[model samples]
Target chain A: MSAPVVELVGLTRTFPGPPPVHALDGVDLVVRAGEYVSVVGPSGSGKSTLLHVLGLLDRPTGGDYLLDGVPTSTTSERHRARLRGGRIGFVFQQFHLLPHRSVLDNVLLATLYSGVPRAERVDRARAALERVGLDHRVDAAPTTLSGGERQRVAVARAVVTGPSLLLADEPTGNLDSVSSAAVMDLFDELHASGLTLVVITHDPVVSARAQRRVRISDGLLAEL
Target chain B: MRRRAAPVALEDVLELAEAETPPPPPPPRRRRWWGRPWRRGDGFDLRDLLAEGVASVGARPGRLALTMLGTVLGIASLVVTVGLAQTAAGQVGRQFDAVAATQVVVRPGSVLTQSGEERATGRLPWDAEERVERLAGVEDAGALAAVDLGGAPVTAVPVNDPSAPAAVSPPVVAASPGLLDAVRGRVVTGRSFDAGHDARADRVVVLGARAAERLGVGRVDRQPTVFLGEVPYTVIGVVDGVQRRTDLLDAVLVPLGTARADLGLAAPEELQVRIEVGAGPLVARQAPVALDPGSDDAFDVEAPPERSRAREAVQADLNATFLALGAVALLVGGLGIANVTLLSVLERRGEIGLRRAVGATRRQVAGQFLVESVVLGLLGGVVGASLGVLVVVGVSVVQAWTPVLDLPTAFGSALLGGLIGLVAGAYPAVKAATVEPITALRGGV
Candidate 1:
């Protein structure tokens, strides 16, 4: 197998409270290059917390996370943010698209913080939109798009920076069956072309599409 | 074909991504001199910060206008108060220059006698007018004295009616030929007595406008004569429009030599000198000395209290009073901007969180909001400055006075608005910068 794009060793996340809550307990995982991995869990199963730690949005209390061979546990917050922008991409269930912006602008904004050159941002955004099969909707506003189309635009924004790892949290939880299949087909096409993807969901049908599946429950993970 | 096309596009994007990756940091030897590494190509630049700020501010027009109102009023009032103060000071100085600023009066020095009565210590020289006229800055000089005509009732008719309802008698004043010119009085009708009249002691009298009206002598062309005591004097002229020494408009004036001979006037009591404006102090000092060269204490002089100093004092007083009021208004305006900007921060918390998530640093986020507030303040300042100029000009037009305003003051006031906005927006910008990215994620989820 190629070098691992993500390595988690003894990662633990604890939230401070009167009685502290452990969101991730001794989680260990590895996502190799060009791999499509699915994390399956129910509500409050620490799936989101694990995703947060993997995306460098939240720091783990103990142990190390190596993203693209760089140890991220001891990096500064600014360095982590830079890594998050240039190397990692996130797709949330709600899409998180700015309604007032044009579809093309939504994708171009991802390049603003990812070190993309100003002259090439438009071309990169257009190429990313074409890859998502939404090239015709570049001039349309996000508010004018359907739920599936908006999700496609969000995916385009996520991939516009050409991130090393793409993280999706319930990407199809709000979509219809037809739209869910369409997005899954897009993911399969991405994985076929050597992109690393980690999709978190509770639906077995969605998890089954991935080459590797991991089940998470009550802050612990078991590979299936 | 589709599978091959996907991989080729992915290879292109991956190649670009690899090329764009930042180089590894230099090996640690000593601590880096700069606190933050220069991330020039990575994060936000000045252009991006400004564009984001402008876009955010332009998103809401109504709120922007409401926030700017306070700054506008504050800046407008400040400009108006300062402009009007300068204009009014100029107007007052001009009016003062016309009359009071150009006059100097010299009177005989007095002493207490052994019997406890005030007596003139020294008499004015007989050629007092000619003596003082030679002094520099003395435009015109005249000698004057009140003639004591021993119970003689001066009247228009020669009939000495004892029971004619006790008519009030007009007083007689002895004056040199230059008195009318010195006092800035104009001859309303007829002519004034000349030097020849004084040399010949011709007994020609000039009637003040009020005195002529009381004596019922309107036309001097017919050679009207008025009786001073028992001697008849021809009324040669009626003098009016006396700017200085307005009391001269209500007296009957006779030639100084004629008063000395016929009315037995002892000595001239006072000298009136009309100097050029702003020459009061110099003329006052020199006139007293010129009147009595041997005795410095022979005369008391009163000059218009230092014209420029008095004008500056008045201007300073006006500026202080109005500027304080304008500052208070400006402070209130700044507070208003702060209040509204804070509200905007609170309202846009989610948006701010989203920006933070999308790779904007805390400084970048703060900078965006700061730029927004500054733009608002600057706009208000420009509008406010224009409004203030208009107000000053309008008031000047209504009052028929010249409007005075400094260009830099107007320009600086607008810049002050931008500065106020910066100060006002600081706390709110900090608050925005502190918003966590997790808020955006949690909110979306």
Candidate 2:
């Protein structure tokens, strides 16, 4: 791939404190098209911060990061959010679905800032849920769903946008072994279908499953 | 080989692209702004939320009813108060306009006089008022002197027949042209006293129509004369009828000179003083019509009209007391509306947060909430005004009074309701505007 999907150079992030916590330190990384990369780190190793920055949820303290061959350091917050919505999909371990809404509604909320038409929302939501094999539970309240099923619903919400990148943050952290394997298989299938997938996890199994693994400790990525 | 060879190149490529990855369906057919104005197209769609919002409220009608009830009662009270006060003001204006300040009265003393008791004081004669006119700044003056018909019951002998109606003692008042504009009884049957009649001491008298009927008189155009203690006084004109204002009827009107001659008195009949240009009377005379010495209840030598106004003032005080109580209800209602609006702001914080997160500015949120509150208050005003009218009708029906509603009363009360809304909603709306979106979305009060 002549133009990498992601490129980060000399990334440094520091928090204000008595002893300023260095969340990220001079990290350099790259991923080409259709690559499945997993990042692993111990506690306080800046795993989530790295994921949030990649997902455009937070402004970087210092970095030269390019997305789709375009420099992201100069991008405005609004542009970042649009790019995040249109070009990158997110999967969080906690699901974070609104409990008051139905499964259909929770998935539809992901599409709110994307400017979808109001008329076709219901049908579209139903179709998204069907893809995750929960079409029968379209109107079921989110609090009623099983853990694995809820994670699948979250996955459905993420992939409904058909973005070029899939950013999963500890995707299987809340699942048991069997459910974890099932989700991993789904990730494998998506990768085979040519999505650029990034999974942030400490799971050795997930690390082994990805075609590439990037390990970090104390805010620096180790060359392996 | 299996597929038809027709358009094979284009068809196969299109199918392959679709199988690999689908394009984004041309950005979801960009909807017209009115059709889908909001950018977040997937919001609880109007249909979903409208039904759901209503359902959310309907799920507990008891609470909803209580909320709405507070608004309803507040509005009703305001409307009723405004309407009743309007009616009272209207009736008083009409009555005042019909028989306005006609003449001035002068007694032996000033209003605050500590002289001899009012009953012993003398009434200014008809000629005395004419004398005052000669003083600088004095204008045309007349006298319409009166004595109580209810006091010292006297003998009455009918002019046409002595035994007619057995007996009737009408309230006798001696008046001249000055009283014409003051009484509802205008001369309809005969002509008024011209200068010739007064100078000649013609004794031509104008009878009130009711008194004329009582005396069995012919059409007064011929100008007949009747005996006052067997002293014949000519009939000059007859008025339609005198007003029965608080049981005082102006039944007999005679020129001052004629009355003086008839009574054989050196002093003139009661005097009426007039200032040059509508200035209220400076001095007045009152002979306590019904009082002895050392009494606070002594009747005054005030102009009959002035005394009537005093009576009106007392009635007005009573009216004001009721009106003030009504206003209190309105004020309480206004406060209730404000309180409810505040509670609504707090309760709907989540909804406000959601709207803000979707790009609503703080002003828009405040404006929407305020508009809702005002609309609520104004609706209450309309109802309250109606209740006010109802109150007027009830009072009049029960007391035989013609209470009324007027333009200013209506306008004032309606505006008062709006003012209440503005006053009450101000702080709450500010509080709502100060709310932070992120904090509200976090749902921590």
The residue ranges of model 1 lying beyond 4 angstroms of the native Cα positions read B1-42, B73-153, B156-168, B198-202, B221-233, B256-333, B387-405
What is the per-residue lDDT of model 1 for residues B1-445, given as tens digits with 9 covering 90 to 100? 9989999999999989988998775443332110112234545688877776776677668877888888999999999999999899988888887888888888898989999999987788867889989988889988899988887888989775678787778889999988889998899999988788887889899999999999999999989899988889999999999887778778899999999888888889888889887788888778877778789687888888777786777789899999999999889888988898888777776666556555667787789889988888898899999999999999999999999988999999999999998999899999888877766567642
* TM-scores of chain A in all candidate models: 0.98, 0.92
Off by over 4 Å in 2: A117-123, A177-182, B1-173, B176-252, B255-445
Question: Number of the top candidate by TM-score?
Answer: 1
Residue pairs that clash (backbone atoms under 3 angstroms), model 1: none
Cand. 2 Cα-lDDT: 0.61
Question: Could you report the DockQ of all the candidates, in the order they appear?
Answer: 0.19, 0.10
Residues A1-224, candidate 1: write the lDDT tens digits: 79999999999999999898989989899899889999998899899999888988789999899999999999998888788878888787888887666899888777887788777778878888887889999999788988888889888888777788889989998899888898888787777766799999988888999999999998998999
Q: Model 2: how far is B394 from its true place, Å? A: 14
Error of 1 at B24 (Å): 42
- The C-alpha lDDT values of all candidates are 0.85, 0.61
